[model samples]
Target chain A: MPLEAPVEVMLAASAGNVLVWVVWVVAALALLSSGIAVVLFTNPFYSALSLIGNLASLAVLYLLLSGEFVAGAQVIVYAGAIVIMFVFVLAYLGGRADAPWAGGPTLQAAAAVVAAAAIALEVIVVIALAAGDQLSDTAEVTGAFGSPAEIGDLFLSDHLLAFEATSIVLLVAAVGGVILGSAMPQRSKAGAD
Target chain B: MLGPGIAAYLILSVVLFATGAFGVLIRRSPLIILLALELMLNAGNLALIAFSRQLGNGDGQIFALTVMVVAAAEAVLGLGLIVAVSRKRVELDVDKLTTLSG
Candidate 1:
């Protein structure tokens, strides 16, 4: 009975499971396509728009990963707040589209693609050969797993130090951003001209 | 346990990260670079959450949370610099911003 338990978990099927599977596949596809759109789009504004879609799909994927609280945070923080900042900055900067790899070292672009593909291939091969079957089992979680209350408990207990550190990091980043924004010398009539 | 396993999620992560890296390497604009950087970070987040699910723990989720904060900070600073560069009426290309004494 114990020996067959793992196989049962592996092959488990149900209506809810089927729904989750469908959502996972849809989100995964959206994740990949939007990611490509972010990279391949020459228009930075459109890329920013795709970034929103990309992050939104990632949030959905997070939900499938059992990251309930983090999934919400992903939507609110990354998808909402960060992307809005990107859009605002793009607008303020009036970023006209620029061609990527425009007049650059032709070989460098090729090398970049090759190198990235090599890295992905390397990791996938390692996963497939070494730990593919063994790592397929998802850990059984408690009912309260990934809930905000549970995460907050963690923040106030086990992860208190790191939690506090993140606040400090955000504070420092805010101050640094302000300083950096004004650090440049203005040509008296810079934007006006 | 439904259909795809952790491997599927991880492979997706790898592809996302590689696409981001390729963009970063080839893109000239800082804005595009930052967007690519987000792609890379999300790839990392997806992997973290996948592992968290596989391991059935909140630790990876917390780590992912921290990563999100760091990412927000990075975006703020990067955009601030971009704004500063533009206010100076300087061309906004990372490759061209080689001089410090400008």
Candidate 2:
């Protein structure tokens, strides 16, 4: 509505929108670094670290996309909890260098290249679509969702089922991992004896 | 041209997703693969949120929230498996994990 008012008003609005674009650029750079990390690092530890950075960057990007609740959750769950779990497991497994890097034959490399090409093509399509006037919607992102009270309402009311499900899933996974990990030592000891 | 449109975000997400996919195909370490999987999932989440904002809907953000939880769960379970397997085998070579293949 405001953009349709007048030339001067539209110019003013566009000027104000520059702040959001600047943020977008910064977030994009962060995401880019994370992507490069994923490709270059063979070590799982380094990969995990890069993934953490990537997750944190994605969380900020989520904020820019107007998903404040998701953004905070991304940081807390992904960067905080899951990354810790990954690092712990990696340490227990004697780090990434000891793990196998080339598990398959030479064909896998070709496959990887093909897959990368396909992904690049998909991105090109998305870029073309975005350039056209196909998408017409509100760009306003709510800042209030990041507040405690509003977030609580959204968590309890709008997403109660999913929330409960996540807790249950995490509980199951924790117990299962422990059982599996603990059993290995005893099994190996029996074989040695 | 890339000021504030949905395409800029989409293109970026695609690159991120491609990198993750390439990592998945190239890397043999399950832990690294799992991390790559997380990257791919996050790329999808970015796309979803961007589209949701472009369409003025709350559902995309909601789905992205769910995906994050699932990704966490996946990482926990996945790493646990990696640790358990490594106790005896000592190394998790993708080629060596052929128990499933006939």
Candidate 3:
């Protein structure tokens, strides 16, 4: 009873409360704005940059979730490698900015909006229902939840097959990329010369 | 510390996912579409990590890592295909790709 009192008091402290709220608000805004920019920007390059910003903010959010390894991987893999690949393709396919949204099929757009809204409503209801629930004893969080060692143990023990299979898939993708890139007649001609 | 609760994280994930879906629906460029897809994937990752932390489980984080790898490979192949296709034709718009038309 005494330990619970102090724990609750600590969580209620003004400094920690304000700091968490501030970080959460800033990260959330950055995530939302960058996601919008990624979609709305006319230039592909700008969209790629916005996507990078979104990914970086998402990494920060992951850190807030106490997923340290996931945060790092998000920055390194998504922001660094994937964005670079996107930029490379954008640069290679030089062109004018895409045509302004001329309002594609109205039915498709309406369906998309309805589907997205339905999903959002469903999530909100689920969150409301789960708001009062607490983690089970077996799932009680420790400081090591996202530590590298914990992740490694999980990967090696439970996810070993998946981990190995991902390697194979990546290898195939790499070879496929090479074939697809070289298969272009223009690329082949340039290579021959 | 009074950290943001699971509901906050879930709300953010929902918004992000919705934005990505809207982007995919509204945008015409293939590159932009791909970027939107990435946004959706990241949103899913966020939800997974949030639940993982709530449950004190490492499995979700590992799964997110696997998702990232798969996403990377998908981006590589997708961009490669885009490059090859663009070389043959000038338009990179997705609507014009009616190759499957009967």
Which candidate comes out best when scored by TM-score?
1
Candidate closest to the true structure, highest lDDT: 1
Pairs of colliding residues, candidate 1: none
- Clash count, predicted structure 2: 0
Off by over 4 Å in 3: A1-13, A103-111, A126-140, A185-193
Ranking by lDDT: 1, 3, 2
Candidate achieving higher lDDT, 1 or 2 = 1
lDDT of 3 by residue, A94-174 (tens): 734974356655777777778878877887787668753652222457778797888888889999999899899999999
Candidate DockQ values, in order, are: 0.80, 0.58, 0.67
Each model's lDDT comes to 0.88, 0.76, 0.84
- Note the B-chain TM-score for every model: 0.95, 0.93, 0.95
lDDT of 3 by residue, B1-102 (tens): 256777678789989998898888877788889999999999899988987887777888998999899999999999988888887665787888878687
Q: Tell me the deviation in Å of residue B81 in model 2.
A: 0.6
What docking grade does candidate 1 earn? medium
Clashes of 1: 0
TM-score for candidate 1, residues paired by index: 0.89
